[model samples]
Target: MKIFVLFAFAAFAVVVFSGRSEVSQANGRYSTGSIDAPTGVRSTVNLYATKVGVYWDTVRGATLYRIYRNTANDANTATDVGTSAGNYYFDLTAVAGQSYFYWVRAENSVTSSSFSEPASGRRANGNVFPGPFPPLDPPPSPSGNSVTAAKASLGKALFWDEQLSSTNTVACGTCHRPEAGGRDPRTLFGDLASRNPGPDGTPDTFDDIFGSPGVPKNNADGTYFDSPLFAYRPQVTKRRAPSYLNTGYSPNGLFWDGRATGEFRDPLTNEVLIAAGASLESQVLGPPVSDIEMAHGGRDWTQVAAKIAAVRPLMLAEDVPGSLRNWIGGRSYPELFEEAFGTPEVTPARIAMAIATHERQLFSDQTPLDRWGASIEQLTPQEMNGLSLFVNKRCIDCHTGSLLADNEFHNIGVRPQLEDRGRGAISNNPVDDGAFKTPTLRNVELRGPYMRNGQFQ
Candidate 1:
């Protein structure tokens, strides 16, 4: 666990190893065939058969690709072909008798969307799916004013409410405790922080935190409330929780594995990708569908919603007319919406915007080091020496910049005893084998059980 102790100084006598990160184009969220080109650039034809197999150039930012082929004989008989995220699909659909049409799209755990254009050729099949996503929003806060106080308050309430959980006992705040640097470290047991059942078949109970029931021989005191949130065995999470501080700055994607992105698909946007770019509010609401996190049993959102709807009134609030009204708001949902977002239409977009507004506020620009002593000029001589050593050891290479993260995944090659795959599971990329994001050292000394694995350095 390379705990960096930074000591910045011009040690003329010492070799200070420091280098800037590659200024790669900002990561984009636009998938192929999704970006809106000018009207003049639109192509009319869908399929042009020229070659034996369909092939296209590599699209940027795509890790998985799919080709949708519709045969000329039938408009409804469409074939779905799945390819790796970065690779183009084979053009096998351009059969001689079939006037085949092809449309391509990109998808990963976080995002899925259509292509911007179609490639046409007289005798050859051409794929016009733009090979990459539209670049990330160039700037932050794409379509709104700064987040507000009332919105943040509502967000905090929603984030912590157990009614949001499948069992109606957990909320976003359960895992992202502020004191533990805004993340849960209680993997073994404790509070609403986690709901994992023990292998010993102990009964769920809040006293030990997981609320697990019947993993034990006789611990179910007959009054414990550890009923399975589902009818089947639960599906534990593949990974642990991530923090929130400084995450809103990551506009293009979210999560260490990027399992979530700013361009989450909500019908409210009508477009597959909109308002993507990291926003604390957006990142915070994720994982309620995870079986081990907040998911209902092992089911997805629909199942979880149905199970909890009777006990949880908030789910029905979706159709109550006002775009922003919930039990949290005293006035009509529309009135609350006007106050929070200046609109009363009550949209998922605005809901996301409001939660995002509150989340961005979680950015902790204030730290003891930031206030009392930091920067090249403010450090004490000893602390400065430590920082210098930190940079010398190549720590600064990853922990660079004001936010102190290059935001790239690297394989530190820690002891791989744990089940966690870090970024590998989210990306399915070999390059990220046993790798994790280089976390921000903004308040490292205050955070413990270091590393995403939390192996206790």
Candidate 2:
């Protein structure tokens, strides 16, 4: 007599046969019966624009493989996408920008194995760069207040003057320097104090942020106070300082969340100064009163105006630009104000206009990319290859245009949305969670430690 037994494992199967011991001496045999499930499955889109390449390790007992796909992660929702004799499949129906999860099953003439672990991928849209560069739109200026040489000069002085801060140590230029591509360079030093624990409130984690350092916590009387987060040390901003270079070109709004609207309103009077196209002017009014950036607690525009009135222009700054120095020789803030505006009286609106005017002059159109696009110069072979890859890989989808940015917000899945609400905080939309504005690539090499949180070097 003989007995047959079959056993199935998670990934393989076995068959056994046994004979009665007394009959022809006890004998045992084992044989393979079922196929193993596919393993080491992965997906990619680097090779083709319209297809997602799904690949896997060849199974020992598989004669053919069946591919299944769905928009969600669940395998139950997946439908048969295709079949292949080899260990790979090209999903031509995969759409660009939309993510798809995939699974593979090994099969032979008799039966099929269970589905393998799922892999996810998406196809690139393959939108190439448009032709030569186009001229950038003129920088917007506030209505009734053009950018005059005198106004820009006054704004330059204010921008670089440390005395504008309540502690007389920080200025607009303290964090934004031209040499560093209008971004803070101090974060590159690896200062532990400059780090802000993200929403998780933990340190040395993936969500840790490298941010710009500002003045310590201060009382309304300009005295230092212990901060809950930093103690006596200088307070750090929640987000990294964005580059000021070429910021004038952004028309929708300013800042990572686009909170700085184009309408410039007088801080004190709430009167609309610039009705539209004055995002630069609207942006300038923020840092001066921000307690963490440049001011003491409860500091108002009245206090800022009074402080400017009391201090001489650029009193704490050195190596002033020659034109500004010549204009400011033996002059007071009131005198500079008189030259910039109609009279010597210092006000918040005039201050914003002057600073915005100065910032508008910081155009960066002389880059190598610009020269190549303009047909004034040629790109190297390596550069041409890089440009080709940049387009082919679909990096140009969001980072498009002459500015190399779409000036829109997108959540690229850099981190979990719970860690940072990002544009969602401003827009109050769940879909905008973790979305950040696309930054310009002009002089990008000079600005290291990129991203809104400065998570990448």
Candidate 3:
């Protein structure tokens, strides 16, 4: 009877082992075994604003990785956010100023491994400052262009008026939107239509530039013309549109290349309009007549002035701000101009001065960082760590002071020097090759597709 029982036990063990083998080999691709769970899981935040980067040590046979995320620390409750072929994944949907827990699992054709240990991270709120806010210097203004309510009001109308463009479809505000932190929102498309082939003149290359689209090419007779590069589409700028936010704080020139110098010169008469501290005035004058931006080919300041003189202020705009609407109250462009410049004439100089006056009022000093500096708020621990890293990493060297920029040029090597000369072309100096202006970090989270080429989002 004992011998019979031993034989039965051995037969049962054999059947169990055989069934396990068959189950393992059920998926033909993984005849050997199941995938191992990924280990050494970690997470980081704010590498890009509002993004969480989850990483793990690679599993030997991992054909793919699945990233899981949760607001709580419980991995069991975590949901799969995305998949990657590599060991890392960025959660772009992560909300700013929120903490997230992450886990990763390795997968093969046959099966997925167990969930990795949960790791936590949080995107920096950008509310932390190392010290108290410094005193801000007064914004520079040209001698004759002091900011006034009347001038600024007229300028606001001009800025939003699509009628200012020859096509009656584009305005200064079209590119520099307030909600986008004063940059072009179209650059975020990240498609071929928004890309500019750098100096290499080749699309889909390393030197490809993400830039802002302007008006389509137009003949002097207000007729559309086909462009060699864009065909019937709008011509794009070579560089990304710099944010107009906090530009009032810039003591030097404006634009990525600093082509708009401090001295504002008349476009037609060769007379100096604003001799010093007028970079804003100089910058505003370029787009009105540029064939690639707002006007027809060979358009002159006289044509722009004549067009403005004929049209009603902000005629093509919708949802006009309540304050501006009340101020306008059925006024003509001539009346607005007369109230702004003490005359009915709308000259190029008056246009620039009025626009600059309005732009100067766009000060962004009431952010969370400012609130923290004023002792009205506190920063999270993760944000404090980011502040420490910002200083220790020497980021403050180029980005200094209250404005968070030195108002200088730098060549951080986003691309090769030959691709875009930047400040070099403006200064006619080889040493400044690839040097672009240091933009302010204020409200930087809103202005994405960062850098002069808009390469990083």
Worst 10 residues of 2 by lDDT: 6-15
What TM-score does structure 1 among the candidates reach? 0.52
Q: What is the lDDT of residue 81 in candidate 3?
A: 93
Better of 1 and 2 by lDDT: 2
Q: Name the runs in model 3 displaced over 4 angstroms.
A: 1-138
1-457, model 2: which lDDT tens digit per residue? 0101100000010001011000011011111566556666778633235577776644533456799999999888898999875445679888876888999887766778788899888765553235734323335555756755456657778888898889999999999977777799886525587797767777677777888999999987767988877888888888899988677887778988888888889999999987887888889889999999999998999999899988988777777644355556557888778755758999988888888877876655434554455444456655665666666667678766767789999998878876788889989999999998998766666677888888876
Error of 2 at 186 (Å): 0.7
For candidate 1, write residues 1-457 as lDDT tens digits.
Answer: 2233342221111211111000001112233344211110111222222222233322223334566565442324556744532122335335433344555554444555545244332222232232111111112453443434345434444555466555555566556655666565454443323344333334363111232221111111212224353233333333445665556677436776665666645533445434556444355445555545554434444443334323432443323312123223344445445545555555544555555654554544323233222221244665667666767787667866555667777777653522346677777766566677767665454344455544343
Query: Estimated TM-score per prediction?
Result: 0.52, 0.70, 0.70
Instruction: Give all candidates' CA lDDT scores.
Output: 0.43, 0.71, 0.71
What is the C-alpha local distance difference test score of candidate 1? 0.43
Worst 10 residues of 3 by lDDT: 17-26
Candidate 3: deviation at residue 95, Å? 38
